[model samples]
Every structure is written in structure tokens, then in C-alpha cells.
Target: MTTAPVILDRAAIDAMIGVIEGRGHRVVGPVVRSGAVVLGDLSSTADLPVGISDEQTPGRYRLTARDDEALFGYVVGPSSAKPFLHATGVPVWQGERTADGSFATRKPEAPTPVAFIGIRPCDLAAIGIQDKVFLNGYRDGVYGDRREGVFSVVVNCVEPGGTCFCTSMGTGPRASKGYDIAVTEVIDDEEHWFLAEPGSDAGQEVLAQLGAAPASDDERVRVENLLVDAADRMGRGLDTEGLPEAIKASMESPRWDEIAKRCMACANCTLVCPTCFCATVEDETDLAGLEAQRVRRWDSCFNEEFSYIHGGSLRPSTYARYRQWLTHKLSTWVDQFGEMGCVGCGRCITWCPVGIDITVEAAALAAAAKEATHV
Candidate 1:
């Protein structure tokens, strides 16, 4: 069930920040750096990307200044909630052998509590996908601990980037879940305030601390109109009605070869994707050869060794590896997690050096399947 929202002018947003930090949570949110919105440590409202906007396309990203003071004028960039929740490189556990020929292992201390601010709906859905992977029967202690204490504040996108298609995925333009507080920023000629709503107990408590007033009917109407405008503004989309079946049917298509011609197997797509969970482990020893540390690092299916077995790799050719990645991400993932692996954040499209858009590839798969049916 949804709760009625409250209104907060731009000034009160800072108070909301203080409320989260007051609870000892390290606030992590978007910051403008190197001409793009990047996630980093945040202290106050000034730390947000104010008057900053971005232009995103396949294989390109450029940041431009907005005329107004709208903090979240742009949509998501390459970064997601993935980094803070699951570090790219983490030490799983370390061990040392004593003189008595015994071994002792020690796990790291629990992660500091994190408060993720300015999250978008699609990325929040990506977080949910990861939860099923990391918190299911076979749990990941590192990711689980970091995920447990997160205080999430989601912001609805009033405008969509050129590569955005969360609407096609049924994930966004408006925030839905996995957030404590959901806010809609409305900056127009007459008003410049946020329509804020709390979705959890912590959110309610924090919102109360901000001393916000009940949202007016006009304010609620403005918020709804913003979402509708965003939906129409989305420039890209993927028709995913029968995506899993389409991918399964298009395996023999020559599209794989076409993609392999351009894909460098750089693994940028997998790295930027919020839900790709493949990782590799390494064992390192000190100069004494007695003390050692076990390191776990994020890995990608694009690597040659990713599909290695006793005899040989499951996918030896470049085309085979690329196909495996696409198939798993769009098809087999649904079988394993009961949902599509993609959350429509467009990170893969924007970050890919070759501008290999997943939506384009998905459409090609459907065309290939159609040709096969005629054959």
C-alpha cells in the first residue's frame, strides 16, 4: 500500500540529509565530477549535482550545465548502487598458519552503515535482482551485511536520457520500491519544492524530523504530470513481451557473428551492469609465506577463462562468449531468479566503447527468429 506524501521546499532537503547522517550512516549520493554524475561521499545538499545535466548515448556521455537549479535534471549515469553494496575488489577472508601447524582464519568487520541517496527506480530494481542472487539460499556475507543497513532515498526522474528505457522494463520514470523515501522534484515557474513520501519506518521517522507539511492536491497533480512527461520523453525502448523465448530461438542466427565483429570483449557492459554477479578469487601470501589473504574480485563472462572446465572452455570463440553473455543476461537469468536480469538503467549502452545497444540486439534477435520461422 502507498502512503500520502508530504511537501518539502528546497531548504528542508538539507534537514533530511542531516536526519540520515545523524543516525551515523555514511551518506552516499551523486556528485558532479569529470563531467558526469558519479557516486561519492556526501555531506550536505551542496554536495549534490545542482545545475548539472548530462547527455547520454550509445558509446558517448557528456555533461552540460542546466539553466535552473534542479539537482536531478539528468537520469542515471554509468554508476549504480552496485559499487557501495558490492565492492569491486573485496578481501573475503585471510588466514595464517601458526608454528604448531594449525591455521586460523579471520573475516573482516561488518561494513559501516550506508545511506544511498538520489537512487532511481530502475537501479533500485537492479538492487532487488542482486538481492535474490546474494541473499538467497547461498548467501554472500559481504554483500548481505552491506545491504542490510542501507537507508535508500529514491528520486523519480522528471526527464529521461536518450538511452533510458525503464518504462519498457516496467521499472521507472517513477520510483516504486526498495526505497525508504521517494521524492519527486518539481521546479517550475511558480513552485520549486519536492513532493516527498516515506515508504518505510525509518523513512517516516526521518520525514517527521524534517518537519514537512502535507502535500497539497496541486502538488500531487504536479508530481503525476512529471512522471507522465518522463514516460513520453524516454527516447529508447525494448519490446520484451516474449524476450526469453526470442533469445532462445535466435541462437543459430548470424547476428552473433555480426556482434562479435564489433565487440572487443572488454567486459565494460558486465562491469557497469548493476546485477552481473560473477566473481573470481585469488590467494596471496606475504614475503614470509606464512601469512596470506584471500581476495575476491568482480569478474566478467567476457573473460576467456570464465567458462573454463577440465577439458576446455564452454565458449571458446568470440561469438560464443558474446552469445553466452547475452543469453544468460536476457534469457537464463529469468529461469534462475524469476525475473529478467536487465533493469533498463542504460549503463551498458552508454559505457560500451562500441555503442552496442542491448535493445538493438534484442530487436535483431526477434528478426532472426522470424527468418528462421519462414525457413
Candidate 2:
């Protein structure tokens, strides 16, 4: 069953918010705070980043005010909806002393329903990658349950940031799927509105509650032009043809040494990445020693302890850790999950203290290999 594409004017924003909240779901969207566009719990359309946009490049991010008040005027932020769906720190279970001194364990409570608005396309692609890791085969119950109740509303990128390479990754300028609803905003000197299409039953139900009209022909054309302009403005791209094989072949390359020289092994890249799902568990006990709890926290391969097993660690050097992080993300991840782990959102580039661009490194390795073959 298909719901007609609709025009969502500024007024429709309130209606949409109302419908989602009325259903007892927490609505999360992009909001400007502490000099960045970040995901925050929304009470109304006023919370969105109005008259604001962001500028991003490798190791750089700044917010700039726009002439117009377009709701989703910014590109992606440091974090995505990933942290919400896949928790960074989750209580696994609590244990108490039993009558016989054995521990009795109880898991944490289930997640409540959540509605996401203002999610971008590259992040949507990353969410798809995470779905493969946490939801397939031997599943992660916490991440799976958190993801199941999400009412996702995707916003197509009208202005991709400088570091963004979703075009090269074939993951963006627009989100084609994986959301309950998708929206594209078209703003001009005179008017601003969103062209929306429903992608699921929940999306259709929300639309039915809003009483929005079918999108006009002029509005549809505006959206087409909007996306085309966005594609033109995208600054970076990765050459992914033969990428997995090329990355594997570059294991012996000198690029890893170069990366290690600049990389501090701080793990900021993995922490900010939407698709990186490495986690570590810890058990804590009180002074009385009668109760204990096991908790899960997001972990990174950059940590020295991550590769530790038995007598020593597998990735002992900074270079080896960097190599594993990049190789697994771009190469072995395809083998493991049948999809590339990176969606070209470029968070690893911007958030890194030294600003290492993955696309640049991947292309350098491939080009070096091609030149060697020619020689």
C-alpha cells in the first residue's frame, strides 16, 4: 500500500510533532547547542536549528547563520542517531547474593518507543550497516530492541558538508530507504516547505493524522533541483571500485606507518563513527560485596587492551591498531557483514585531533598499487 507524497509546510511541522508525541514516543531531532548542531529531545519545531547551517572539513567544524530559517539547514554533526539506537553504555545485568551465596542476575528494562526526525542519508546508510552487525545471526538483544521501536524520519541532504563523501560511497545526497518517512526541504526567497513520502505503515499513520495535501507539481520540481544542487556542492569522494581487495593488498604498504606518525591512538574516530560497534564489558561490586552489576561500554580497537589475549596483545604497535581499524572498516567488514562499514559521513575525519581522512588514505594506497603495476 502506497501513501501519496505530501507537502509539509511550516504548519505541518507542529502537526507531525503532535502526532508522534501523542503516541507516547520521545521525539529526537537536530538542535543547536554548545556551538554545534546536535541531536536533542524536541518539544516543538522551535528546537530545530533555524537560520543556521554548519561548515565541515577535515579537522574542522563551525556553525554559520543562514539568511533563511530552513529547519534542517546543517549537515551532520559529531554524533548521529546511532548512539541512541545502539547505546554507548548500557547496564547488561545486576547480580545479587542468593541464599547459597551464588549470584542471581537480572537484566535491564526494555526500551521505550522513539521517533527520530532530521536524520541524514549517510547516517541512514550507517544505521543499515549496524543492522547487519547487531541484528543478524547471533543477535545483540539490547541494540535490537532499541532499534525496533524507532519511528525514523529521514531528511535528504540539501547541503553536504566539505568532508562528506556519501556520493562516492553511493549512500547519499538523499536517503532512499530505511526510514518510516523521508523529507526533502525546498526553500526560496519567498517560501519554505518540505516534500515528504511515507516509507512504512507507521509513516502512513502519522501522515493520516496530519491531513496534509498531495505535493503540487511545482513543489516536486523544487525538490528535484534542491537535490541536484546538493550533489554539485559535495566536496569529497572515495573511489570504492576494487576498494576491499586494494585495502587488503595494501597491508604491507608504508601508509600505515605514516598514519601512525600522526594518529595519537586516542580512539576518537571509532567513538564518533556511526557504524563502529566495538564494545567492552565490566563488572562492578559495592563495598559490601553483596551486589554487583555488569555494564557494556563502547570500546575501540585503538585501545591496547582491545587486542589483548592470554599472554600478549595482537596489535601491540600504534601502526598495527590503525591498520586494523581502517582495514576492518573498509575491507574485512565487507567480508564479515556483506556491506561496507563506512557510509562516508566523514566524522572520523573531522573529529580526529590530527584530521586523517579515510578516503585520502584508501585512494593513496590504491594509486600506489596501480603505479607499481605500471612500473
Candidate 1, 277: how far from true, in Å? Answer: 1.1
Candidate 1 residue-pair clash tally: 0
How does model 2 fare in lDDT?
A: 0.87
Over 1-375, each residue of candidate 1 has an lDDT whose tens digit, in order, gives: 346799997778888888899998999989987877988898888999998889999999999898889877888877888988877677899889988999889998777888988989988898999999999898898798888889999999988998999999889988788899999998866668899999998899899888788998988998998899899888699888888888999888899999999999999999999889889888889998789888888888899888899998888888998898889888999998998899888999999999999999988898778677788
* CA RMSD, predictions in order: 1.4, 1.2
Candidate 1 ranges with C-alpha deviation above 4 Å: none
TM-score of model 1 (CA atoms): 0.97
Number of the top lDDT candidate:
1
lDDT to native, each model: 0.88, 0.87
Worst 10 residues of 1 by lDDT: 1-10
